[model samples]
Target: MFLKQIVHFSKKSIRLSYQFQTMSTFTSRTNIVTGNNEWIFVDNDNFDYQQELARSAFADMLHDHERNIQYEKAIIKTLQNLSKSMKKIHILDIGTGTGLLSMMAARALNQINNTSCSSRITACEVFQPMAKIAKKCIEKNDLSDCIRVIDKRSTELDLENDLQGDRINVIIAEVFDTELIGEGALRTFSEACKHLTIDNENLHIIPARATIYIQLVESSVLQEFHTLKNISQQNQRINIPNDCRHLAGNTIFDLNLNELKDSIRPLTKPIPIFHFNFKHINEMNNFTEEKILENIQCNYDGRIDAFIMWWNLDMDEQGEIQLGTIPVWCYDDQEKIKNIQWREHWIHGIYYPQESKIVKAKDQVSLYCFHDEYSLYFDVGTSPFPPRSFIPAILSRSAMAAFNSDKRRNKYIKVLEKSFSNSSIKRCLYFGDGLLLPLLILEIYPNIELIILQSSNTHLNHCLEAILLNSTIKLNYQIISSLDKNEIDFQTIDMILSEPFFTKSILPWDNLHYYYLIQKYRSYFRSNIKIFPQKARIRCLALEFNNLHKIRSPVKQCCQFDLTPFDEQIMKASLNVDETIEPQSLFEYSSKKPTLSSIIDLIEIDFEKNFYDKIEKKNLEILFIENGICNGIAFWIDYELNENIWLTTGIENENDSWINYSKQGVHLLPKPIYVQSGMKLQISTGFDFKQGQFLFDIIY
Candidate 1:
């Protein structure tokens, strides 16, 4: 119990707590696939990730296959009408893989037993093994009478004068990746259309136009390998710089090919394909390749469900022989035709985007071309071109925009377009504490080239826990120790931490492993209290109150404090120090094996924790007996304080009589111990005494 005073000061440390409460449960699912180098496909048990790979071209190719039977039927219906008198027809199958579509068309023509028109199917394949297999399939289906397979690429079509009937009337090929860039489709189709088609006849292009979409992903792969730089000091050590690459897994770029499809848009369009005055031919060029763009726009705006390019061919009113895109039309429900056997053409792509906007030209976004292993069948040797330099300024801006205001201010970032750098530079630096992820913007200030965080090992695991709990930008840590010199590389950084700074502040208190530190700094602020007094007849401590408690005048001689009889009673009652046991004792650290050396650390921290918890404080005056005994007083400091209780040393010598001095007034701040003597001593309070119940103790 005590009287108190209030003081003012600047600065305060406020602790606020927040938790990211999420309700989630865990369940395990299994996915397994097995195939030889010849073929590869993920078994059904797993989730489909085809679009995630190579622009989902594999899905597009697969779709072509699933539609093979229907395609054959469509063309057969047209063929049946064409020749009541033609007698026979010959078809050229280019880029024939697995013979799915070629075989289907062959059987359809053969099934009708046409005396008026006989048909022959010639399959041309680039890959030798696939051609050999298609040859066997012709024999297996008893279509050898009508179908003959050529073990040559489609580009070699111009050389072959053997189309069963001298000149082929129909051409079929399934070759379009999502970007329409894979499988050399352009070279094959151009040559076939030019050299083989009959005069004024149309050419068939299967799965013709492919629409591409670019997206961003949250992949751990890129982050770990992108930035590379090191920092160090001149004090004799070396450091290594390392980086990683990862994906954010979000779509930032989308492009459409509807115009490109309605008319043929070749990577490099040739004005004339042979001298043939093909019936209807319209096309466009100068469109983009598989190239990805960050901000994009087109003349028209649509969601771009997927690119659709079908057949446009020349046939008489009788539906006479002609060629064009595959007979199977594009299917909106891509998954319904999953099996490949009846497919008229292989499907390759499916860009089912999330949160995608139907953007027109000049819309800012992020995009990347990726290979998705999640597609049902893996490509034999397919991957993607190294991505063009990209950035996710949109995502970053969005995360920032969430704070303070719900409205996003992304319009300003558009200045990046006209003033963008044309030079392709990739200078990188990857040195930031995982503990401070959020401090990235303030500290980095757009300086880093790239940051790749290691997913399981470095980033998610090694992150500091305190930062995770207390702050959003916990990782923007400050340097407690500055470098003496800046030129030294930090790849092999090995610097000793400063003594008091490393000990009392840098490391968190609760979970530290400092048994050795306790040994090393036995004399400095230790971690526990082995050398401290368990029970002292006399003790002295000082504590500050203005910062927290607003307490003052702990000395018994402070006349400035007005203590009524009621206040005096409380102080005397509070003097029993046994009840003031701290919630956590220095001995509790003993169980954790804290040594005498580490025990001293408690002194400094206890000073901060208990500064003005109580109203009274003290100063060490002296230690003597009631009989006037004395020597050089000695005791140990259990904790540090600016104004606190003072415990006296047990009396050593004595001559007799004693007098009580606190009789003048009750102590409030910095309790001073004085042996009673003839000299008149009064325990008056110090400055800043306010009226209140800051009751404290002056224990014997």
Candidate 2:
């Protein structure tokens, strides 16, 4: 047995707690030991160590001052309501993450000290590390006697042993996930009502009730995450089947929807679909399935691409101190909305249908919301409503809209049109997965011989469908099975066109797939053969990100709590992985002027030349122009379409139309580096076409 001890300091004295751990009890050799607490897991790979840190919870919950203030007010009200009774109160704080709520409850008890009531809080946490930290935090707040930290999940707690056979009178829990019931709140509530709570009418739940609100809205901005739209090939639209247009996917979106209200167009009024009564035992114990059917009348004529959903919490019994997660535009009182502080802990949910719904003004549409034990699903109907059942619908939607993006489609049209219209280009060969360009090119130049080589069957099928749909146009074309250099007649072929992409892409440079193809066919090409992108270059620069780095690199401490364990986990998990750079509007999360030297070119490649053989590997050193914490590097590809026309996925001071259309790449550092002006930073960069990977190492 291995013994570890934890020492906690208070204003008056220091207290120590010890726990014994046996190696046999652990499923794995690796365990995080912090003070006297050991966090054991089956395998390190199965756990998100950063998520299990107390600092993460502190950073999220502390920054949400609005949530903190509301909870404080609600706690006061709860204490006031409990003061009316003369009985002693036993409170159970389920999922007492950092013991913040338990501390708040203990503080509220101070105000009602003369109520002739004595109160005690039993705070429960599943993670041993967090529970130990919570215990220390409780002691630091000088509330150790009032609140006892139990290192166990609420479900695992026994009434006879853990609670000393006494049932709880007041229950306070913050077990809700992005989706209100995602963290098994329903099960927790059901079990608590059945076993842990007292059989009395005076039982009080801090949050009396919760209601979910939803509205149908149309937004091109929101659609960027769902389906890819085809509106670039001479104003052509991709036709989707009507049967595939109903509820497609349900996902919890945790962003500030209030900021996106300007881009959103509401099609229907907001409606309350689901309600959960936490205070009523019978209400919770008997609850199984929740279903809602309503005749929703459309107020606007538009395509309903998605549903915007949020929730409201009734904090007290009277519902005077209510907490809401509605977007700013949803509120009628604009002044009040502006005055009310926003919260990050709770955000809105966005759901996209399988197919977009087209509705006109005053159309009576049937809206249905159904839920089982853990999740919610929504649907729509007309005059004839469908019978509801417990059967689960496939509520999953694809987030990849690469094939559907209008901007991408437009770029392809411009490139293909340039290739087809040039009289010098008689014979052309294309190598790309995007089928739209080839079909569009064939429509324009019917006499030119076009050879296409696609490896993906899905891309080929899509092309076949487009060819069938556009049967009116005929073309001279041949699609070879492979991109074999021997099959192509280089002497006659005047041009080569490609979108430069592959299925296995995580970073922006993965599109170097185009360079690899060009290199493979370079020896067989004619001297005069033209390439669409005359040149391609990789640009890199240092950036001082605001909070964006936190997603990849864990902070050492948040709100004065130690997060070294989390930092270690993040560094281990993130090493050697080619991270996917999410398309972020950096204006929101990154500082533009980290240094005066902005976006310096790192490497350039000529598409027409065999540059892959003579690879450029450099150990470049750059100096900082200003003093700031350099968290990471941002890079993007600059493709020279022609001499004057260039396509770049980099930062630009452009309008929403341009920014939304472009994509930039990023790589977060292991930790932030505070550099002063003239500080030299060394970066080792290399790209191997054979391996199809870009290597970058930052050396300070």
Candidate 3:
């Protein structure tokens, strides 16, 4: 019997050891070979690793002093009030990422020092990695004894075993997205109240209530994302399909509405639409579906293109300590607005109605605001419109904005018309993700044979085909998935053009894949094939971002509690997996160019020349003209259509503001460096053609 026990123990130990070995040995590998044909193979241990990191914008939330302070105040207030009555208090922190709130609760309880009242705080985190980190953070702050870190989600926690049968009197949670209930907050709260908490009238929720407010706006800038407009050229017109025109994209544009002040024209004053009381379990349970009809008086005479949505949190029970997500213009006290905390975690959301409405000043319009358990939708007029099926187009708002830009569309039109008129372009090849340029060219010269290199996205291909079928013009175009010599007569192709877009292109330079394609199919092309963008230039500028830097900044401490463990883990993960250069819509982020050098052209690639002909390296020196802290280096592409026609995906005008349409590449520095006037900075930049990646290093 002893021998049998020894053998069983040995087998168990071996199994456990094997499992650990397998986990430790697991690794991710990526190989990129850029030669005649660029090849990339990526095998990752976890496919969602990068996505998980990106979605968990913890640093951004932690850096939000306003949110932290408000939460801390609310927690402290709740504890103080609860301690007055209850002999023992139990606190439950739901979705406790990094254990910030749990630590706050522990500290709050400690501060109260109510000898009669004892407190037990339990923090539930679903993400195991984050849960472990939270435990470490709690320990680092010396709150391990006071707070219990549960690896399971709040719903998964057993009241008897996990909670030791302690009835939760106070529940603190921040399970909210840009849209108030989008993150399953209703279900979470309802389930907690039903299963996790004891049925008691004195039960308290930190955020006692929430109110959703919306303002009608007339924004031509936002209209492009929801509907496709007709394209007209030289008496010929390509009409958008009726279905496509009315298709209200299901996507909610969550952004900092303050930055889009120039784009949005307010049609109506902000009105409270939906109110949810978190403190009442019955209220949250009954909030499964709701439709509120509001008669809003329009203040401006314009078309109602969209509605801007924001929410206010009544953090404390008394409703005095409140947090609002309203934009700057909504506030009457401009001075108070300046002091209001800016947070990307809970920015305003824009919801497009199924169809836009035209309203005049003093006109009372009936707006129906509807919300289910997880999503919100709206309709204009007396009755709610019929639910419309989502039809995918260029779903990316940035891409839609780029295609809708009159200035950009005109540039492509002019260049295409001039090229067609000047040259004997019998056949043309379109080699980009965007269909606007190809459609425009076809509209101008229908007789010209066009071959479109089909994008990787199958949905986009289907949408393009539908548009083509709906067009009145007899179009001669073929969208081929690949450049097969047998399928496509490449030698007969006259010119290659693009909006220079690619689904795979995350950074601005990723669009350089257009040139890479040209090089790949150079052998099949005619000797003197014309390229629409004759050359491409990459430009760089040093910038000091206002609040954008906080996304990557570490949260060492929050509410006087040490959060270094969370910071260290995030920093390590970022160093290992995060991209050096990230793509950001710079228009949304306010940044100032350091008084260093003017925007410098880093490198220029001539489409006519072979990309792999030579290895490119550049070393440049820039001197600062004034003292400033440089946090980021912004880079953008300039496509030279001709000697006179140049299209920039960067700062277009002399005002130095980035064009709102396209996202530019920004390389955030590891840390902000303050530079004195006349300080020389050395920049070493290179393009690795073999790997199809750019390398940049700045040294002072």
Candidate 4:
């Protein structure tokens, strides 16, 4: 009865909660909207609760036992030291998402004073939904009497009303991002010290200090994401324009460097770049901007491509409790470091220099590191004091990676060369967002006429034009921004091809837009036309993740505090708006393949067939070969370029390894199911044409 009542209450609360929606506008004259007359409303509530809960990093951070225990130890030590000198103690937690840190302080105070009535603990969360959840969690842990929750930003707090005229002696916060200062940690600390706390010898901060470290490396793989590279087809070469070769965008690429061990070659040992003391407000104020020059000797003879950055935090005043984000290669005990807790919230940052530098062994190079209040940039040799403003690139980092993939480039070249070798093929049409595939076909047959169905991105089209003009070979091609019949002679087109990539594609199967396009425009093409990728298969496999599952897992307890209410809210939100399959870069995450079943083909699409004719429901069964917990099902698409050649956006080996360029689709189960050996499971899968998505249901 109690469980039923709780479920009923949760449903009621969900309905009462306000849903914030954004009103999109069509600014382009080409965009046409046909609908009834309606006035869209707007407000200050710009938050999307569904997206927040789906992509929340709270669960991932909480699952890190090392981080949680270190924080608890730091808080206990701080409170213990304060109890010796002060009669009254007040603590403030800024941006407390789940009240875990606030609860830790409350519990530690109770242990020190036998009763927490002598001390006050206040927590502020600007997000109302999270503030309510935090209050419920505090009540669940029976710490409501000691800890106070305020649903307001720290900058909006009133010292008299919110803090009750009690000057806070200690402040706790976790506002650091991958770049440490990118989330405005310095601003938050400066404001809290000025308005929320008292200036005294007893004033304390949880993370008293932070030190950043960087190491230069020469990696051709990393260089692909920073700038455009020249492409060669047969004896012809397509050169990148001078303006686009060295251009680097301002976006930071943050990922796990441990997975790319084979790709990166360290050119120099790690060196300290910058250090900031968070305990002192005056010191933080003085850190608005600074430039440091270090002379380092190179250990390897290679071109310096990029720098890898990570930081370590001194959590307590004594600096005994420390947490670092160093990669395995940096430590002597690599295996022990790998065994440590993995955290995605604080990963390594990969920063590219304005230009690549060639260094010899024992060569001394002058490294200049510059940092503003919230961002970091680097340079080599004696250039200007501060680096020049970053020039944005037309292609994103991911798009460049796809273009730089050697495997993909080789396959496409072979297929295109074979097709163009036939003199009978005169005209062709290319559809997709890839810039290189289209160029490769043009280079293979310079005299053949080609029409490109350009993507919605105007910048990509500009870059394509620039490259074509810069190349030595004269190419015959036309780019059509929209699918207009009058723009080209579609009936004369002999072949159609695609890289099967779309700007709006979010999942592996979303690229089925190619198939949909072929079906929709079948009347315009010739009856005997050729398709580069004749068919596609949707494949799936059962697997278990090491720590990726925690992103979607429910947190029942964290830091000795019950979080049932938080879990219930997340469940309700997920049911309403969360997608079953999400796109993830599987290469950065670790997973184990199940011993039960081999890969299964859930759906197959033949571009030559009609959509309705190929739609069918499938019901299959599989038996578990070994006992293990099934947590997720991974999916990828395999494109058959020819009778003997194939390409996949998933694992390419028997060892369950993935290609680093593309992201795969993953469906995490609501709850992990334990299966015994020889246990049978049923799977039902199909496609919903109306929604333009695939569906799957698994039963054990």
Task: Encode model 2's per-residue lDDT on 243-306: one tens digit a residue.
Answer: 3222223444445576567789999888888888885423443445545465688998998877
Considering lDDT, which of the candidate structures 1 and 3 is the better prediction for this target? 3
Tens digit of per-residue lDDT, candidate 1, span 38-117: 11222211211111211111112323322444356555665554455455566777766556667667656756666667
Worst 10 residues of 1 by lDDT: 587-596
lDDT for each residue of candidate 3 in 451-543, tens digit (9 for 90 to 100): 998986787777788878887767898878988998787888888888888755567777887888788888998888888888988888877
- Backbone N/Cα/C clashes per model: 138, 4, 0, 0
Model 3 C-alpha lDDT versus the unseen true structure: 0.77
Q: Which regions of candidate 1 are displaced past 4 Å?
A: 1-66, 158-165, 202-700
- Please give the lDDT score for candidate 1: 0.30
The C-alpha TM-scores of every prediction are 0.32, 0.72, 0.91, 0.90
Candidate achieving the largest lDDT: 3
Query: Candidates sorted by TM-score, descending order?
Result: 3, 4, 2, 1
Give the per-residue lDDT digits (tens) of candidate 4, residues 262-344: 78999999988888777564444455555656568899899999999999999997889998788778878867766867887
Task: For candidate 4, give the lDDT of residue 431.
Answer: 82
User: Comparing 2 and 4 by lDDT, which wins?
Assistant: 4
Kindly indicate the candidate among 1 and 4 with the higher lDDT.
4
In terms of lDDT, the poorest run of 10 residues in model 4 is 27-36
Model 2 earns a TM-score of 0.72
